[model samples]
Structures are given as structure tokens and as C-alpha cells.
Target: MRSQQFLIFLLILKVNLKDVLLGFGNLKPGLKYSVLIFAVALPVMAYGSTLSDFSQYYPIWKPASDSTWNFILYESAIAIRMLATEFFYRGFLMWTLMEKMDERYANLIHSFVYMLMHIGKPPLEVPYSFIGGYVFAWVDLRSKSILPSFLIHFLGSLVFDLMIINQVFICL
Candidate 1:
């Protein structure tokens, strides 16, 4: 669902996959900055699930059984979903906004829209989504690619799921 805009843009612009995934010329700054961005986000992700009752919202821990293959598949699906989300937000929306306006305004608009999309999420998450969205947009704009934000978002989601699984199922 989230990837529809990205797909439509790709069709209209006839943009290539590599350029869309990596962004245009001069990729070094984005690449260099990704390490710092991920490092800073690591600890936040470590404690993310503890911030709210995400399990009540997602109910994913019910399937955290000893089935390795099932767990792998679940995580894989999450990764794909997160990727699609990042592409939609940081890739399609951000870049399209940048084309029409200044980068800072684009980031703000993108962050607001991103936060709005989190309206049905855990209560605490809805407000914080704006901050996280802005930060992710900054990283995407700096790196000129959604890959960095995608990595952070995907790993953060994975960590949140793992933490919930560990607390609800494993630790029980």
C-alpha cells in the first residue's frame, strides 16, 4: 500500500531502480553520515518497545514460538514492509516535495504527513513519530537515498519486535 506512490512515480518519470535506491550524483556524504545516524539511533531502538504497550497494538508476540522458519518469515515480511514505508515517505514524498520547495520545508511537510500516518499507532508513538520522521528525513536528504532511513527503520522495527517477543514470550 505505501509503495504505490513510489511505483507510480517510477512509471511516470521512467526512473531507474539504482538511481532511485541510491539517489543522484555524489553519494559520499549520505554514505558517510549513515554510520553516525545508525549509531545514534541504536540505543533509542533498544528501548523503543518499552516506551509503550506496542504489543497491545500489534499482538505479534502471540506467534513468537520456537519455530525458526516462521520467525524468519515474519521478520522478512516486516523488513519488506518497512522498506516500502521508507520508500513511500523518504523517497517518493520527500524528493517530490524537494522538487517543489525548499528541502527544510519539504522535510517538515513530510514529517507531518508521516506523523499523521501514525495516528492509529500506540498513543505515545503518534507524537514522537514527528520527531523520528524529521530525523529520518534529514538522514534521507543528507544521504540522497532512502536506504539509510530504511535500514534504521527496519532495524528499529526488528528490535522493537524482538524486545516485545523477548519480554512477552521468551522471558515468561
Candidate 2:
């Protein structure tokens, strides 16, 4: 599953793997921007977690239950999935679109598609996904790589899972 999009991007699109994944030029700015955006997002995510019962929807941590090893495995898998997702959205889609059109339109297209993917998730999340998607695309464009957005997505998801766990197991 992870290799499919990458293969398409490489073979079909003829995009260089490094250009899409590692990007060209300096990456420090993207890294810093990712950190700053996440810092701001933490509080918003925290509050959003309170607005909905995420456990009913995701239940991602439920399968692991009480096993520490299982939890680690789940998180690892999620991180890998996020990597693939970023590659597809930020790397494949955006880069391909940018080749034919303006960067803004390409990014907006990417953001819309990105948001659509979150439709079945939490209600609040569906709407904000557009905003988050746009920001992530912007960060990827600025950094010229998907690494920064990948980190943000993976870490934010991990934190949200923890918050849901707290609400499900600890608070209740």
C-alpha cells in the first residue's frame, strides 16, 4: 500500500523520488515552520478533543488495549501511513499540479482533496482539515519537501490519540 503511490509518482509521473521526498534546497525553514504551527495547534487540538467523543470514531488505541508493545506498534504503523499520505498529497499531487498551473491553485486543489479524505472523521475535523491541509501544503512548498508536514501530521495524530485515550480510559 505504501509503495503504490510512490511507484506511480516515480514511474508514471517521472518525478524524481528525492525531489518529492527529500526536496531541494535548505529544509531548516520548513522544520521551524512545522514546529511553530504545531505549537499553535496543540491547544486547538486539545480543545477540539473535548468537543467530541473521538473514541467512538477512531478507537485506534483500543486494539492495543493495555499492551505497551502493541501501542508502540500501532503508533509506528500510523507514522508510516502518515509518511505515505504526505508523499501523495504534498509530494505527488502538489508537485504534479504545480507543473501545469500556478502554485496557489495547485495548493488549493491539494488542500481540497486533502480535506475530502477526512470527511468520515470527526465533524469538527472535517471542516478544519481544509485549513490544516492548506497550511501543510504551504509548509511543504516552502520547505520543498514533505518531511516537515509528515512530522506535523504524525505528531499531531499521536497527541490526539493520547488525548482520546485519556478521555476514554482515565477520565471515565
- Name the candidate that leads on lDDT: 2
What TM-score does each of the candidates earn?
Answer: 0.78, 0.87
Where in model 2 is the C-alpha error above 4 Å? 21-25, 167-172
lDDT tens digits, residue span 58-119, model 1: 53544644555666687888787888888778877887788799989998999999999998
Q: Model 2 over residues 1-172: C-alpha lDDT tens digits?
A: 4557567648776667776655554589988998899999999988876765565665465675465566678889899888888888888788788889998999899899999998878788877889888998898888778888988999998887777666434643
Candidate 1 runs further than 4 Å off? 1-9, 16-35, 46-48, 59-61, 64-66, 167-172
Which 10 consecutive residues of model 2 have the lowest summed lDDT?
A: 163-172
**Residue 28, candidate 2: how far off, in angstroms?**
0.7
Which clashing pairs does model 2 show? Answer: none
lDDT of 2 at 49: 66
